[model samples]
Target: MRKIIENYGSILLLLLGIALGSVIGLLTPHAVEYIKPLGDIFLNLLFVSIIPLLFFAISSSVANIQGENKLGKIIGLMSIVFLVTIVLASIATIAVLYFFPVSSGMASAGVMESPTADNSSWGDRIVKFLTVDEFNNLLSRQSMLAFVIFSFLIGIAARRAGAAATAFTSFLNAGNEVMKQLLLLLMKAAPIGLGAYFAYQVKTIGPQLFGFYAKPMALYYGFGIVFFFVFFTLYAFLAYGRKGPATFWKNNIVPSLTALSTCSSLATMPANLDAGKKIGIPPAIANVVIPLGNTLYKNGSAISSILKIYVAFSMLGWNFFDWNTIITAIGITVLVTIVAGGIPNGGYMGEMLMISVYGLPNEAVPAVMIIGTLVDPLATILNATGDTVAAMLVTRLSNEKFAPSST
Candidate 1:
């Protein structure tokens, strides 16, 4: 029992904190404001750490990589896996909504304030989405995708420079280690940090969940549970057959809980990175894929987009099943999910896409946006932990010989 506790201490503590916070939120809904700041401090710490962590982790891994083609192959396979899984998530959500359906007759919903709106052309928005206007913009958490691109470029350039860049490579590696240790120290506070955040979330959002949001929330969460357990299990199995699932589940627990509590993919990146190492993925793949996944991965985003669209349709009395509308909505969801994660105000951007494409009223934005908020915990779990499994699949497909847990 002592040994078990020793091994599982962090997760046990995390779960306990979450349970306690949840109870507090439920029993006393009026006090989350005081608790919310504790959570914010933790999240801010995570956000601040991410840029350096991405820079070092990705650049160092890529710089240390041996064969040039190996990196290319890993990325190619990783893209395919990301796309396939996202499509599956989106389609699955559509299927469930077909059977279960999500309608609230609350088409008149509107927020006290409007979401951020960008009037830029699609071509311009796409360009800005991937590349920033200046170097300083890359440092912001909002420009994560751009920073990832910058880091990847730095890695590729360094790798090409060969022996000339060896000293720089060492610096990158050292920085990665330092940032990782910092993350470890940061995680020591997660039980309190995330527990506080979860309390606020439950207190503020709990009542809404029980109201008109219940039906769609139920549908989203029902599918989320299946996707988290069943599909993730299947992906693990495929990555290494029988041994894969056990390895994944073992290393994945803390990351899963972290995502559930914090509802932030970037906040969960360190745990995913650790899990990737334990799961035997090459650092080149894990470093690039996990961080990149935080910026661009679509499993959770895809499902959320679909549900948001369905809710709007059902409320507006439109036939969501219209083959053309379904096709169009799914396409929009995929596009939004793909591009939305990297930018500031991404959720608002996604809402904009849904409203514009479906030609819905502005009021529909807040209605569906709440769904994203309510479902964020599970959605983030899928987004963050899915990166670990993705790295496994990429390793296998790239011929890297990843045999489950290495630890």
Candidate 2:
């Protein structure tokens, strides 16, 4: 049984969460009263792990990347890819909202926040809400960006300090390793947390909630999956001319599976590296691109953020055409979401962050949560594929020639 769970844990837990959530949605009458705490617990648990995990993983990964000679150019191109992918995601989200507008009443009907009489004006409120750290605070109420920034500083200091920071680096590396193990252990409880969270969400919201933005959500997810195929095919055509795409999946499926099972690009690094090497990607290219990909290749999560923003705007009856809002949403999504693609269970947290930033209706929060739970697997697949694509793209950008036996 343990072996079975280990093999099929993520998928099994995800399904069980959905089934339980749906049942709860179907049967529970006052889901808001009882389900809130459960959602909070799951989110809290997930958030507590994010900062530590990101700090060590990103700092260490970045350190390893910069050690490479052509690292500057590689990092630049990867950053561009990350930005462009996020923009595309934002566009896809806006398009979904425009195409299938969910009624505002669906969100406004049931809840109430005490109206403020001051009316300090929308401009003032917008300015405050749009602050960078404010959005981070909204999600986990922790300073994720600060933590990441500090981690980078520590990594740089470690390299510069030589032996002084050696002991520190060793400790951090060990902490990261231990935390990874803890993550594995924490994931064992995902089914229970997800089940409770889902049950609470669906039990309270009911199936009708799905109809609001379900079509658009599906479209967003479909676009990401389709991109994976398009990118893989393009890589095949470019690298091997007419025949490469045919064998791309054959050599890379194991990495993809590992990515799916693990729900992390970083976690699947070994496999991705192995697959890339098998396909003639050199150690130089693999070493540089794979790690950078972890920080700047969140095509899946980016797309989800875009879609969620649109949904939120639609539910709030806000003009979706506001350039400032659109631009800001895209910018935040791009910057914060770059590395988030590889994070297990990150999409939901991302949605919460975006929603809070926009001051979206509280009623719509559960809807976004439900979507996150449902789409985690697809998100995992896209995150993995995005990394592979980045590796190929970065290699091409760096003009690195791959030999048939390069691995």
Q: Which candidate is the best by lDDT?
A: 1
lDDT agreement of model 1 with the native: 0.82
**Residue 274, candidate 2: how far off, in angstroms?**
1.9
Tens digit of lDDT per residue, candidate 1, span 1-407? Answer: 99888778888999988888898899986787888899999888988998899999989988888886888887889899888888888878888888887666566556535556778898998798789988999998777888898999999999999999989999999999999899989989989998898898788767777866888888888888888899989998988779899889999999988887777788889999989888888788899889888877857778888888888877777788888988887788778766666322356567777787777866677788777777877777887888899888888788778744434
lDDT by residue (tens digit), candidate 2, 221-292: 567677677855775666565646755665566556445434555555545555666666655555545655
**lDDT of prediction 2:** 0.59
RMSD of each: 2.0, 8.2
Model 2 spans with C-alpha error above 4 angstroms: 1-69, 92-213, 235-244, 339-341, 404-407
Indicate the residue-level lDDT of 206 in model 2.
Answer: 41
Clashes of each: 0, 5
